[model samples]
Target: MRLTRRDAIAVLAGLGVVGGGAVAVDQFDPPTAETAETGETGDGGGDGALSATVTATMTAAAAVVYPSQTEGVADFVETYVVGRARDESRRDAMRDAALELDAIARDWYGDDFADLSADDRDSLLRELGVAAADPVADGTVSERIRFHVVNELLYAFYASPTGGRLVGIENPIGHAGGTESYQRATMLEDDAGRVERAERAGDAEDVEGSEADE
Candidate 1:
């Protein structure tokens, strides 16, 4: 379903991001330093480490807008957020964008954003995109809001095993492809010879038993 600015904002607000606009955020400076060197889970993805109330609120808000939640999803953000989501300066942009989208939904629908049905959610999302087409739209709601939601949806929508199924990738890495020639060719050579010898011996024994019976 298409996502609207309000749906995104409400989800972010639920996550913890406060305020609005394109940059309603700060660097994701978790008071505790969970650097890559630490080799330990830190704030954002690790145990007990929470993000900026605002960023988290925003992330959570985006989850709601997308209407999906699964394990380890937030961790994907923790590992990748610092490196890829955006520049350090716009670290909180994702969260903020989500919140802004949710707020827009709340204002337009006159109800809690999460309470909407799936069909309702999609309709609102399309409307948000349409509204942004109008140059005179108010507030921070814009096509960019849709972009943020799209990013969030990419993550949230794919959080399910169902999503993985859709993409044809299994959870655990399967065996790397193998060569038929290398697997049994060498190992079975001696084993097959031994089996043939044993079969011949067994045939001789069988002939002796048959003659004795006759």
Candidate 2:
């Protein structure tokens, strides 16, 4: 089933996944402006840190999940996922999700997800989605990937200004161009006849009153 941007948003919202306040991974300081600009997480920061490897994995995952017919997907992922993620814990979740994908790849094919052929990577993601949907299992890794990684990425893309344009939304939330005021359809034209009739009745009433006075 091909999911539209709206559908994806609804799903994420329904799951209570998107707007939750940030979770702190640890005491690691947030990314500096320079680090964010460079898209590097710096060195020796452990599981919570965003590294080049994590960035690469996220880039690959974004490509697979939200493939654009046009280009600039890498930049989009960097801006939305790496740069604009709500807080450190959110970033950590993204990093961990990528690592989870790698772990799944290793278990299935003896390779990292990044090393897998495109077909294999896609196949593995499909399986991951299936596993995530099991009703009996709650808070499983598959469920986390589905919500934290895949759904979050989808939300980020569609909620972005560029992604919004793809689906005909002018400017999304953090950018400019949101509607200043929502204009409702006016019924002036449809009500024109009724207005004219009321005017005529008032005129007739005035004439009758004048004649009675005389």
Candidate 3:
């Protein structure tokens, strides 16, 4: 389920989002200015707000569902769900249906779902897998947010530098080095040919320069 950085983002974009442990419990200090700028280059929008009530509920159930959320789950849902609700393209009826998805949490556990204990959170999210997949609910705020959260967990593991190295997934960028023993031969051949051609061209230029000097 791990995904390289590109793959993780692509997966998140495709899922429209998934649970992120980072969003709920991870309280990772926001990246420094430079790193935040880097994260923003590809992700168009950023964080949003949530109340203490909503946050506590999401910590258990929602955080497990999404996994790497840290303390930002509320922000994510606000952007993707409420923002979408406001847009003209989003239907009022569908928005209402989406809101209803949270009923399960309120009715089953009481309070906002986020406030539950870790064990409760784990229990709730595990239960959600079967329920969230139901298309009717999946499109709503409840599962819709969870869907994104799940991707975040997968992304964190896969996008990590060591994660990529562990899985033998090559960086599409082709600059990062790989384990020597496991190197792909085709990679070396292609690089060698490119280097050889560049060297030959450099030598030709050097000869031409020398002749001119003479």
Candidate 4:
């Protein structure tokens, strides 16, 4: 099944996967001073440090979910995933989720999640039913990983200015009036068409109401 951004959002929202907001996008801020120094926000770990294992697991997950052929994906993971996870109040949950993913990998392939081949990792995710319409309802460990880890990484990606450009959003939120040219993807164009149609329908209703009043 093809997963559009809208579908992902709706499914996550329905499952209450994105806590505290409609989407996890609002949960992130730019990296902090401490994050720059230590590559973490110091909230997820016991010593307020991010574990390398957790970092590796999340990075692997990001590769599967938002596989970019670009050179800076590691930087993106640090800036987006680590940076956002650090500031998040639910940072502990994110940490535990990473460990859980590692455990799953060890159980299935006798290796850590980061050590798995790309194909094997993707296959495992598929086996865990990550693409299921309502994985959360089952309350399985795999579903929790998908919700807490995969969804968070995905939010970090698509909400960033760089990720936005992939789907034709040049300036997502902060970088207004950016000069980068954007070619709207078919999905975005469809979204715009839906919004336009909804507005036109409302206007037609208003006109009919006015005529009836006359």
- The models' CA-based lDDT, in order, is 0.39, 0.50, 0.36, 0.53
At residue 205, candidate 4 shows an lDDT of: 29
Q: What is candidate 2's lDDT per residue for 1-214, written digit by digit as tens?
A: 1223232222222233343333222212345666667665432243444355565566677677775463565544543443333355665666666677778888998987777776787788887763345422235777777766667677666654345556755334543224421242422223243323323323322322221231
In candidate 2 the C-alpha lDDT for residue 124 amounts to 87
- Residue 25 shift from truth in candidate 1, angstroms: 13
Off by over 4 Å in 2: 1-50, 84-86, 130-138, 172-176, 180-214
- Candidate 3 differs from the real structure by a C-alpha RMSD in angstroms, to one decimal, of 16.1
Give me the candidate number with maximum TM-score: 4
Residue-pair clash count for candidate 3: 35
Screening candidate 4 with a backbone cut-off below 3 angstroms (N, C-alpha, C), the clashing residue pairs are none
Q: Candidate 1: deviation at residue 74, Å?
A: 8.7
**Higher-ranked by TM-score: 1 or 3:** 1
lDDT of residue 44 for candidate 1: 40
Please report the TM-score between candidate 2 and the true structure: 0.56
lDDT of candidate 4 over 56-170, digit per residue (tens): 7877887888844534555445434433342355555677777778888999899999999988888988898876734352257777777777877777666544465467663
Q: Encode model 1's per-residue lDDT on 1-214: one tens digit a residue.
A: 2322322222222233323212212334333355546632222443232334434544444444444533343433332232223344234455455556566667887654455555565667677773344322223556555555454445433432223324543111211112322344333322343223223323323322221221
Cα deviation of 175, candidate 4, in Å: 7.9
Which one wins by TM-score: 2 or 3? 2
Q: Output the TM-score of candidate 4.
A: 0.56
Q: What is the lDDT of residue 27 in candidate 3?
A: 19
Residue 72 of candidate 4: its Cα lDDT?
Answer: 55
Q: Estimate each model's TM-score.
A: 0.37, 0.56, 0.34, 0.56
